[model samples]
Target: MTINIVVGAAIIRDGRLLAAQRAEPAELAGGWEFPGGKVDSGESDEDALVRECHEELGVKVALGDRVGGDWPLSAGSVLRVWTAGLVEGEPRALEHLELRWLGRDELGTVGWLPGDLPVVEAIAAYLG
Candidate 1:
């Protein structure tokens, strides 16, 4: 089986990370996750990330340093997580049902998609 590759973004501002809730349950449904989506055909991971950010959050992201990346679970899907700062545009939830800023303390408060837990830990490690 061909594993799906996804590019996820961890937008940090004022020490808080931006997370979005999936509209419904599927793999990580109802769980809070980084705002991103699968990389489309003919699109590089970086390009896909930029597009996903604009399409999902309505914000322009300057792909900062890559903080973390991994292929967790048996789906063979790879998760590329990056540290990005908002270049322009205010965040308006485009596809996600809701969005919120989560501080380190509140990070564990929300329900995270199973695959996201490792990504979250990586982010937490990078922040500190």
Candidate 2:
């Protein structure tokens, strides 16, 4: 079985979390998710995450804590997430349909993609 590795960022600023809305894949479109992508072969997860942030959000991020253990996803892929702080530039939804900052109490206003929902719980606790 081929296991795919995916990484995500829980970017927070001023006690607000950044959420990106998906713009592709008919099944996942319109869903909210953290802005990161696949870990390319030969690239460290950290490097992929940083590169993804720059590409997806047009910003640079300094990764902090890991959100949790590897999160299981459909098929054999697993998602690894980390808490991130913006190092430079404002977030832009370059690869997403939209970007929104949700405060501690507003995390549930948008429908999060299922694979990303568990991480949200961890984040909500941190936010509180």
Candidate 3:
């Protein structure tokens, strides 16, 4: 079976990670997640990530090291994450209900979408 791929940006600055709150798709709404979206056909993962960042957050990012291996999501998709630093523009919650920068100690303060919780933990381990 062909797996669907979703790309996420773990945009970190000043020891905090950027998280976006879902605004639609009621079931997932209000839950926090890293900013990103699904990859389009023929798009490279990195290109999709950059495009998603621009479309969702109105910002440009310089990708750093990847976070971990493919993280399983519901259905037949996987989430791939990369560390990112802002190369241009500040992030705005264009496609999200809200945006937050959570410090390492504050990671658990918000309710994360199920698929994002593990990635959040992985981020915390390195933020130390």
Candidate 4:
């Protein structure tokens, strides 16, 4: 089986966590997620995270550490998450419908994509 590795970033600034709403791929539209994308071959997770953040959110980020355990995605893929800090540029909704910063108490209030739940929980704990 072919396995694909995807990465996600839990970008936090000033006590708020950034969440993005999906805008494409009919099935995932309107759902919330941490901004990131697939890890290219020969790329480190940190490099992938930074590239994805720039591509999807138009921001530069510094990856801190892993946020949660691996999550299985469709098509034999696994999603890995990390905690990130904004290093340059403000995050913009480049590929998403919307972007919002949620406080720790409001983390669970949004409709997160199913695969992102574990990372979300881990982020909540990290913030507390």
Q: Can you give the lDDT of residue 1 in candidate 3?
A: 88
lDDT per residue for candidate 4 within 1-128, as digits (tens), equals 87888999999898899999999899999999999999898999789989999999888898888866678778689999888999999999989999999999999889999888777877886674
Q: Per-residue lDDT for 20-112 in model 3, tens only? A: 999989999999998998999999999999999999999999999899999989889999999999999999989999999999999999999
Of 1 and 4, the candidate ranking higher by lDDT: 4
- Where does candidate 4 stray beyond 4 Å? none
Clash count, candidate 1: 0
Residues 1-128 of candidate 2 have per-residue lDDT tens digits of: 88899999999998889999999988999999999999999999999999999999999999999999999888999999999999999999898999999998999999999999999989986674
State in Å the error of residue 13, model 3. Answer: 0.5
What is the Å distance of residue 50 in model 4 from its true position? 0.4
Q: What TM-score, over all chains together, does every model reach?
A: 0.89, 0.97, 0.97, 0.94
The C-alpha RMSD of each candidate to the native structure, in angstroms, is: 1.8, 0.8, 0.8, 1.1
Candidate 3 regions exceeding 4 Å error are: none
lDDT by residue for model 1 (1-128), tens: 87788888989988888989998657656678888889998898889999999999999998877755564744678788888889999889888878998888888988888877888877875453
* Poorly placed runs, candidate 1 (over 4 Å): 25-27, 126-128
Off by over 4 Å in 2: none
In order, what lDDT does every prediction score?
0.83, 0.94, 0.93, 0.90
User: What lDDT score goes with residue 6 in model 1?
Assistant: 87
Model 4, position 128, has a per-residue lDDT of: 48
